[model samples]
Target: MKIDNEPDIADFDAALLLVMDAIWSARNVSLAARRLHRSQSTISASLNRLRELLKDQVFVWDGRQMNPTALTEQLMPQVSDIIASMRALIWRAHGGAEHAHRRFVIATSSYVTALFSAGLLTRVADEMPGVSLDFIATAPNSWTKSVLPDIDLFIVPTNVARTRGLHTARLYQDAYVCIGARDNAQLVADMAPDDFLGLRHVGFSSVPRLTASHEASHWHALGITPNYVMQTPEYLSLPAIVAATDTVAIVPGRLAQAAMRDFALKAVRPPVPVPDLEIVMVWKPAQNDDPVHAWLRGALVDLAMAFDA
Candidate 1:
């Protein structure tokens, strides 16, 4: 049976709603066209259609800007509500985030994996036990659209995850510290820049070197490079190697703190100061509206906030 007084929307479309809202917010057809990335003529056509549907002038040109008509001013609240409800429905699909049962694979650098794994695992287990997560080593250098199908996220240093077209959000900031055996004679609470540079180093080169941009700039400014004795693709292995040899490694502060108790190691400030490293969470724009994936992203972002605290 047909429901009575159901508010017929047979002729309405989301594009007209968006055009109406955009024009209202912008107060000018040309400005609204720019905001919506449409030509002014296109916006005018949509506006004409909206006028026909509502049977109102909708707006009036007041010399400087478009002013909403009395009918439009009254109807806009409902229009805006409709748009908001539509977006909420889109984002909250699939029974919302908490109830989603999905597997997500994230490609991340070793330092990020080591630093966040425990917290992320616990969060998923506690909140959404059905959710499964996997972490794999990030690709060496290819941050392209072709790799999007393989991974849900990329947790890497901002400089390394620099896919010009992908979406990126700041995860956390960290600084590099020098780690070595506690008994190493050359290790000190604070050493000279030359002393620090002169020591043999074990470098982390998983995502184009942990010294991606910020630390690299420091070395460049100092006019010297760390004398690397060895290199590894993961940060977790650095502690064991440093504990067994005279060679020291430069690592993220949080990783060094976590590794110190597991290995007989001590962390000291690097002799040369470097800017804080910006670690970011990156994902394909196509996944932006996926509720299950957004849940995982939210979990990681929350963990990052607590880690920074």
Candidate 2:
């Protein structure tokens, strides 16, 4: 066989290959145009271009039926292989969602889970029906080194920002706001700075070894310690506790919105300056180039951006 040395073929444009495949399968210009929902003139023009590029008449009319010539026969197998490979390449590039049966494991806190459960999961289910999700909550320190081989992604508060070998993106910013019982007489008016200092407060603290700095850190920079009546490790319980008791708690705005609907709670601007919490999505650098990971990350960031709207 003579090797036809030609300028490198532009990577087969998938659309053009599909058109060629349609013509090959139908074996008639009118039939292929009908199958492709295109005009016969358009199909003819594309075939002319294909013939010019390949330097061979790929198809010819033999009375009523279309026939392949010797050159076309030689190229048929290669063309079919190229078309099949191109189909798989497109599917994989699109994350193989149509046939994906893989599971994705994510490390995240309960608060993050609660915030994204409804809307995020619904989108995931609709787009990737064959994929399953697992969310694991890990403590700040342990999460740094706890590498699960199956964990495809990590969603955590940006406070745990310094993870080695991970790519991170800020999903959303959560600001602190004071929440109080809707019926509380003291909360009827805007809370004075001193009122915040005087009121019994509920806080969430999981770590041992609490110091004055720890207690005052969330408050204003002046370092006035809050009078703590109760402290719990679970942030989810804060809404219930504040609803039953007169205790006030500073919580993330998203949680405060959720709590306000369930409990008779009013969200107020915090009396003290508190740092804004950034929720971030993270994954191992090795997975950064994975098509599925990129799709999931884009979906998450898109969801987070919708919250602001």
Candidate models: Cα lDDT each: 0.78, 0.71
lDDT, model 2, position 213:
19
Angstrom error of the Cα, residue 141, model 1: value is 1.6
Please give the range of 10 consecutive residues that has the lowest summed lDDT in model 2: 211-220
Query: How do the residues 8-97 of candidate 1 rate in per-residue lDDT, one tens digit apiece?
Result: 687777889889989888999999999999999999999998888777899989899999999987776556545654654665564564
Task: Give the candidate number with the greatest TM-score.
Answer: 1
Model 2 lDDT at residue 67 = 74
For residue 99, model 1's alpha carbon misses the true position, in angstroms, by 4.7
Cα displacement (Å) at residue 204, model 2: 1.3
Error of 2 at 42 (Å): 35
lDDT accuracy of residue 275 in candidate 1: 65
lDDT of 2 at 142: 61
What's the TM-score of every candidate structure?
0.68, 0.65
Residue 264 C-alpha lDDT in model 1: 93
